[model samples]
Target: MTPIVVPVPGVFPYEQLGFTNCVRHGDVLYLSGVASLDAQGQVIGDDIDAQTVQTYENIGRILAAGGSSLDRILQMTSFVVDLGRNGGGYVATRARILKQPTYTSAVIGVSALMMTGLLVEVQCCAAVSN
Candidate 1:
């Protein structure tokens, strides 16, 4: 099936950067790695916990725009900078936000991300409703 780009309002212009925020194909939604970026692509948070919250907020917006929700998430991969220091915070914050650990997920260590202050980037997939 053909993929359709999902339009998320108030998100940064990832299109100009040669990528889309989310796309739907058949019953599945694929999201690019979402960071705590504002409308201008500036990092929004100072630390891992705050950035993890903002990252999930961004993911929620994109998933909703694609006819999905965080509850429908099938899998997620989080790229984290400074895994030794920030990994626990990222996990704890994610647990608080999600409430249920229902989705398949992994957190990977990385040296850096797209932006200087970015501590986490979440790439996700979910089931879109018919």
Candidate 2:
């Protein structure tokens, strides 16, 4: 099993957090939960709409680095801090980012996230052909 790690310039060192961006075992790519953080590792956006966009963009970069794409995504799990206000917003944003047939997904509402003002987090699984 070969593990793949996608490192964005100036992104936080995941080792301190005890995780990698993505891990590849055979053809399957497992991505860690991604937050809407900028290159400086600071959370971005003021609302769910903006945060969701950044989250998807981070996922896109990871997929591309792992030799995959959004179309190859097999599963997605999203966590939202405010289910009532931002849940639908995340889905609507995803629909625009991922225009292809939707993959299996789970949206969970939680009391809070690791950071303040952080509304959403997303993780995904993708399979790439050799």
Candidate 3:
């Protein structure tokens, strides 16, 4: 099956970056790692809690654009710069944001990401209606 790239308006500068925010194939939608980036593509948060919320907000937008919702998410993989310091806040923020609490998830510790000052980055796989 041919995969279709998903676009979320004013979210990420995917065109300049040479990548799509999300892609759909068959019944699944795969999202790229979402960071705490504003419409101008600058990192937005100084701490983990704020970054976690922003990351998920970005994820929500991508999912919506891809014909999926947060509740339809099947799995999430979050990469964090300081898991030990921020993992709890990340988990708490996620719980607060997700109404269904049904998706499988993981939080991984990383030394750094593509951008500096990025506390967390979230990627998801979700079910999209055919």
Candidate 4:
């Protein structure tokens, strides 16, 4: 099947990355891993709480462009630089933003991410109804 790419105006067409924000194949929408970059592509905040919020917001925008919404998200995967230090805040943030608690998800702790100041990254998979 031909993939349909969704470009959130300021987020996609990453010149150096060569990838879009999200791509749709059949009924599934595969979203790229999103960081805490704002509309201008700069890291938004200093801590995980702030970064998580911005990351989720970025995911929301990409999902909308993919013809879906946060409610349609079937699965989510979160990556954090330090889980022992920041896991609670990340879970709280997810609970606050996602109105319903029906999606499947996983959180992982890693040594580092692509950007120095970034503390969190979120990636999601959504199912589009036909």
Query: Which lDDT tens digits does candidate 4 get at residues 6-105?
Result: 6677563454677767899988899878999876678899988898888888887787777788889999899988899998998998788897987899
> Model 2: clashing residue pairs?
none
Candidate 2 regions with alpha-carbon error over 4 angstroms: 2-11
**Candidate 1: 10-residue stretch with minimal lDDT:** 61-70
TM-score of 1: 0.96
Q: How many residue pairs clash in each candidate?
A: 0, 0, 0, 0
Q: Write the per-residue lDDT of candidate 2 for residues 37-109, one digit (tens) a residue.
A: 8766788998999999988888877777777888899999999997998899988998998898658999999
Q: Could you tell which candidate, 1 or 2, scores higher by TM-score?
A: 1
Residue 121 deviation, candidate 4, in Å? 0.5
Clashing pairs in 1: none
Each model's lDDT: 0.90, 0.83, 0.87, 0.83
Span of ten consecutive residues with least summed lDDT in model 3: 7-16
* Candidate 3 to truth, TM: 0.93
Global CA lDDT computed for model 2: 0.83
Writing each residue's lDDT as its tens digit, candidate 3 over 1-130 gives 9999887886976767878888899899998888999989899889888888888888888888888888899999989887888888888888888978788988899989999899898988999955
User: Looking at model 2, which ten-residue stretch has the lowest summed lDDT?
Assistant: 6-15
The predicted structure with the larger lDDT, 1 or 3, is 1
Which candidate, 1 or 2, would have the higher lDDT against the true structure?
Answer: 1
Q: What residue runs in model 3 are displaced by over 4 Å at the alpha carbon?
A: none
